[model samples]
Target: MIRLKAFPILAAALVASLALTACGKDAAPAGPKLALDAPLPETIPAGTKLVIGDPTTQRVVELNGWDKDLPFQIEWAQISGGPAVTEAFHAKALDVGSAANIPPIHAIWVGIPVKMIAVRLRKDHVNFPLFELGIAPKAGIKSLADLRGKKIAYSPGQVQGEVVLRTLAAVGLTQKDVTLVELPSTGDVYPNALVSGLVDVAPLGAGVATKRYLDNYARDGAQVLRHPPYRDDLTNLYVRAETLHDPAKAAALRAYVKLWARAVEWQATHKAEWRDAYYVRQEGLSPEDAEFVVRAAGDPVIPRDWTEAIGMQQSSIDFLAKEGGQKRFDAAEIFDRRFEALAAEAAPKIAVGPAPAQTEGKTNP
Candidate 1:
């Protein structure tokens, strides 16, 4: 049950595993020096293979029949989030992995070279945030200012931890102003912590967890509050630097990026089918919950440009580094822009409209 925001703490074991393997394959013969600006090869050579670790995209690709007629072989690894993906990279077990902006930064900090190959942002992201601040019943927390002297759940390595830091900053309060109850944000840990009064507030992810927390405890005065509008929806497809150095895998990755973009587009265009096939059928969520998950996601936007994304990433790196007492470096160092345009070119354009006023859920209140 490793969650999205726990990579930093879990990464202590990474250095020990680096010498294990490289993409679970024999090291490829060294090829021509790979310059950052080198154009992607036009063709994926026969026998090219990639062990991708994107479970959600895998579901979408399979459901839309987009997994067919590929030039190279794909061995999909059911991996997501930072902890597992980072460990896989350390073990050389993954070629391409999907995660938020934090993992790539953590990888750089921990001396594991990796690069983000593609990026995705939520349209109308302000309203459809990835997380919300959940207040424990009887904690008597009403606003960010009320957080003083209250116990807050913190996972320094995960995005939830980032949210906590950002939330504190919004109120002009530092970590010392409140009690940080260090808790791993995995499965129901945060919710359980709040329910048991172990923490006064915790950042709950938007979909199922937020919905259920409110539904089951609203009678006891449980409440969900919106954090300040900040960009927390930086999802990307990244790979270890060594993987891109191999000619065969690089070619396969180029091809896979295009298909990956199309799969994202497929999910956006065919929401009902995606909800049924992925959220309901595969994830075991009810029809109503599946629909809510899809709606809460708003629209997915794969930008042709990386300017704004890199800026957001840099901001996150600076914030996390300051909060966690880690080294600060230029965020641009972790991005490989060669494949930046691939996703935008492959996917159909969707207009990003204004944020909605409301949605059908108790969590919204």
Candidate 2:
């Protein structure tokens, strides 16, 4: 979250950046940075189709009416995680992809024309992490140092992967110190991988990590190696550069952004309905465990400030790129603000639910 104190300065800087005019009087028109209203073509061409790549178990937009009453039809693709979605973007398979902060950062570094259209902040990121580094009981790993020469499962181009990297770097270890086991970025697989001893340690998914932690505790005992709170890098809604150029598609995206934010607002505010429908029914997760996952997810926010998010991502890129042997690039260029107007327009209207601050990281059954 953008600290309330920093809003004034960030807002002014963003306005000033947006006000820049083209390459200058002598150069070709630069075009508007983003169109909040008028002059943005509003019609969806007949039979226009949009493919949305979902990152995990629930896509809240589909749960609510956001995917309904659309000017165009939406084709949903269950893309598992950020790294996988980056590959999908390369193939031009995703019009809108939901991913963590790492995907676009790595994509932009590799020259994939992608940009974040919307961002959702987890308020609980300030209190508890949505991810954890889990180790098997037999591994006998008591601390970060013990991780050396151990096999750690991770999916590159994902948030928890970055966390693992950061954890290694902090302890003066490099990728060479341990065997890095690369896995598909799916929430379903991490727990089993660890239990079966396929990998000594792994970063488990948000709900899976918590559920497995409880399950293993009762059955054979599992240990959470680490869970970092206040790691504010977030899940993002992104689009391919090609989609941003089509006038009809762009307009539809604007509406989609607003409706998606509305969906987030509804989901965050109505925990029971969301958990029951999404977690218990659809996902087959137990209710008590579902409640923990919901609270841990925090509130979904269509952030008003891009400055904070961009800075956090840039820092991560710098750290990972140097260590992972990737070329350096600017992070500010990775976000598309064309939908900001509609995003802000939909934010304040979500009046039904408790605010992000009220929950304090626990959910009621």
Candidate 3:
């Protein structure tokens, strides 16, 4: 995990530069520095490789036959989430990774300069929100107003922390009004925390996690309440600054970003195949859980313009800074816009419905 005080400033940057220098020494000769608006390199030199940490898109590319014809090579790393990706970037072990919006911002704070190169969101983001509040059994919390004095799980390093903050903001409650049980929301931590009464509330994901929490604990008065409508489904691909300094690697990243966008569209259109291949077969989720998970994802929408996205990020940065007493920076500095149009241009346009139709009777809580 990317612990708040663990990574030091200068050492982190020095290690990242050293790692890139070592990698460059063993690869094809380095090319000239890539300018901000310079055209992308026409041809990637031989031996250009990217260490990709996106497990979902890695599976999508393989299943859809999208990896067989790539000009550059990819080393897929089974890593996701902010903490893992941030740690890898600190060690210079990963070139690019997939995560929510917070990781890139947190990366900047931890002295590892990074940029979000690609972005994705749900077509109907509010209805298809990624997180919901899970109330503990016997907690007697029925609404946001009831949370004034409850213990809530908060992980400032991940997206869940931001959800909790945003949730409180929706109901006009601040952290001072509630007890924030500092915890990590990894794997089954949040669900387990809720069930064990370690916290009265935590943000349970809208898919299998929420489904199983209700199935196992609703009998004991456990309840799941939908958080206020907000845009929380921000998925992004981010890279370390040192990696982008390499022109050859940057060109390779440009190609991967295009494919990454196309992969999102493919996954949205081929939901059944994706659910079976990724959730069921790879992640060991039951068919029902996999189906609910896929439906909850709604449709993928990669925007051609990132102006709105950057605005959202800037708001988040401002909010987090005030809450954590940390210095704030312009959110636009964290995005590399050269690849902004690649995803939208490469993805095939698909008609989007109102929202993912909820599962009929099995579970919608």
Candidate 4:
């Protein structure tokens, strides 16, 4: 499985694959080796379509144009959010998708056969925490415990929805203790939901804390509730198992991960460009708002392996099954790790013992 922490997982895909062979897709005779550091084959075999569902447009624009230069032809699909992306996967309309940690966990429970390919960690760690649950100032809710009997937004299979359950569990409560208002998993929807009083509290990404995004809400009436920091839920990348079985698709997926890291590093270094292209130009956000997002996006890091992410997911699954009433499933069975070699080749930092402190671009995703 792919994970990140103190130790950089440099080269362990073979070993991880060995473990995967005991069960699941990789158990058959090994597929062709995916080249992580080298250029891909000159062309994709005739008439093969690699459909990619990119919720965020950033991936296709990496390195200014790396994706456009890939060896294979990409049939890019414009998808909305995680839930829609999951639906695309189930319908076989999508071969690859990216989302928060919760989406895949829910997919597995529902018997969708997708696998987590790679994970992106926050560069600053979580001192401020990019993700949080927020409340309206007049909602009269001061903390997590106050959520009991209140109506809150829930994005069924996404990160925030699961976090809502975990937050309830942390207080020795459950979903029945509060009313859950189901909503799609998205960052933009949360603030509007909170401001309109559609829901008392909403899951938000840390970027909402920036002046540009949250200024009106904060100045008028919105306030984020204080609570213990939620555990690290990495921005996850997922691909279909059928794609993994195809050597060409696996190679393309590997290249995509490597290029993604490059793009994240590029975004980190070229803050002005990121704001210009993504924020101001694409989003039509004000200059000030764009600046706030750029600063808050912080740096991005991709861990070489799933050493830390798996346990985080297990806890998520257990929480959902026991508290959220979702069926249980093993974390290992859902992981496809052929891309570890590519990510490990990038050589991301590995924290040895303890988690350091820090905290996002905007509202929770």
Candidate 5:
């Protein structure tokens, strides 16, 4: 069972405050030059702070790219979860951060003011599917149908919860058929709740699922109840709408996407190297487990036609509306594709394709 560590709330609050204060000040002294083989811009604009969330999980691209010696200084900060990252974005404490599809959509429903620029990873394969299902051995929960009448736990506003709910509907089950437990956070504790029998099922990332399986904490004993038919799970880079409106910041935003694209290309070519060294070594996963996890992560690069790639956001919006989580809202209005278009215009030589829609089931239960 995963133990829930007592998070130092005061410490985290202080750290976030200090980091925001630092960004408000003048630029820091020049540090050692970055060693990078990829082409980098000659000058980064002054007062530019690439405030990133956690390195290993949240900002996987930035963390891995740093090892390849990519140019640019990234100010890494630790955030609690999607909600914290969203809060930071609102406070101007973050420039780029990672969040699930739901919070950002909720933000737009309430006018929180952010623009999603690109998609980072896709999850439709075995690893990602197994990870989110949160099946347990002793529970005898073999499929989505078995979850009926069971108490299932998940973070209320997290992407995994939405996936769980949608997965159940795919198998003709609804939230009413099962007891839904709202988790306080999407971190380690939610997984522990499953192992300890507090909840029959929980949602987790591929990496965490792999680790638990390898440790005998959870095994093939549980089955993946349902998998998202769409190949890409929307995980993208977002900036304040205000930031995107400014011409200077907008230019920088385009540059950031270009750099991100280059980094994704590098990750694809050197998959094994990154999987072994950075993903395994830094995250402290076993080599075998790491391989499974990396394979599950798919490509870290954003597709050239990101707007089309992230069309799943529309389906999610539809689901939320039906579930009463969101009132009627235009999917096109919530998603701003101008920056992605700008990135494509600048890198016209890159091959891009229509975003694939792999829907398999209905949203209604």
Candidate 6:
């Protein structure tokens, strides 16, 4: 079976096919010119759309609000995963999309003309860890070693699965030691799978894991893994390098990032609003689960400092090449940081506060 990370290449090919059918040689009408000095308009240029994947979550809700606050028309297309979003990007159907660290690397390695424009969120930003090994309560599993011969579920291309594999390796287990089942996002059906005994163990995000714990499907579970430190780089917002070169899209991207930073700050200040609006109403998640998601989002993180982010990317690339049998791709060649620099410069001037004092035994949000 082809790996999940490799799906973007296939998705991109599909996108190319779609793009060829959508546009003719006639020049498309242009959007309004950006006015950097003036306040961003509440609606973007008419006929402009922004396609996103699985955007019903709290983060997307916040982003959608930001879109309304912008100066132009913003249309959103909700797909399933990063690969589909990538396909949209390839087809020119999407202006921006959220992606984990790996698939973008895969796209870049394949010579796709994309650049990381903004940092969205990081796994480590949360006070508690995001990814963890979850064992079914009925399985009598107590530790990673106990998972031997048990079935495990994870999405192949996702960072959670990467964490699971690394954790297994850390504990001296291999794929042979546990049966690996490739699922979509753990938030989708892994909880039901666990409750129904379809899978013995799985790696899951904190929100879903919290829900499962609250639902009583899993018990005495320990975090057999954490997001690998190497993967701490931002899950970025990407645009085509060609788009960045366009003065309109480039300026819009900068404005978008500025709005994004404000959105993050807004979420931090009004956590309760986001919790009620999205997690409770939309996701039907419990209060505890919602709180976990909110606090996890409060890590005061931004995607500035591309050189440092690139160092983190290099570590992940090296690990993927060695352990994942991925080709040795040059990290610098794959990552275009110019957009990040531009966005950082264009962002609003917020007061830089002192770093939070670390307390003993404090785990990240």
Better of 2 and 4 by TM-score: 2
What is residue 304's positional error in candidate 3, in angstroms?
A: 0.9
- Candidate 2: what lDDT? 0.64
Better of 2 and 3 by TM-score: 3
The alpha-carbon deviation from the true structure for residue 23 of candidate 1, after best TM-score superposition, in angstroms, is: 7.1
User: How close is each model in CA RMSD to the real structure?
Assistant: 7.7, 11.6, 8.1, 10.6, 8.6, 7.8
lDDT of each residue in 1-365, candidate 1, tens digit only: 11223344343354334325333463753567555456666666677778788888888777767778888888777667776777777777778889777778877777788888888998878988988999999899888779899999987656777888899889888888899887867668888999999999999988778988998898999999999878889899999887777767777887788888888888889999989888888889899988988898888888766778889998998888888878898887777777766677678564232322321110100
TM-scores of all candidate predictions against the true structure: 0.86, 0.79, 0.86, 0.77, 0.75, 0.73
lDDT of 6 by residue, 109-160 (tens): 4455666555555435544555556666677776556767888886555565
lDDT of 2 by residue, 1-365 (tens): 00000001212332233224211211221444333223445667766666676533236766665556777877666554666566666556566878778877766655677767777776546555667678776777887678889888766667767877877877888888888777754645666777778888887665556665658653565677564433734777888765666666677777677767777777767889989988899878899888988877766655565566777877987877777777777776676644444554577644222333322111111
Q: Which parts of model 5 are misplaced by more than 4 Å?
A: 1-15, 18-44, 54-73, 121-131, 219-232, 342-351, 354-365
In model 1, which regions exceed 4 Å deviation?
1-26, 351-365
lDDT of each: 0.77, 0.64, 0.78, 0.61, 0.57, 0.55
Where model 4 places Cα greater than 4 Å from the true spot, the runs are: 1-47, 55-63, 208-213, 346-365
Q: Indicate the worst ten consecutive residues by lDDT in candidate 2.
A: 1-10
Task: Give per-residue CA lDDT, model 4, range 1-365, as digits (tens).
Answer: 11111111122342233234323333332546543323333345543446665635454365267565566656666554467666665556666777778778777766677777767777565664556777865688866768888888887667777667667777887667787887764546667777778888877776634343357767666676534666644777787665566656665676666655565566666779778877788778888888877776666666655657777787778867776556687776555554544553443332122221211101111
| 69-161: candidate 5 lDDT, tens digit per residue | 434455667764566666666566766666667666766654566667655544234335424566665778766667788887754455766
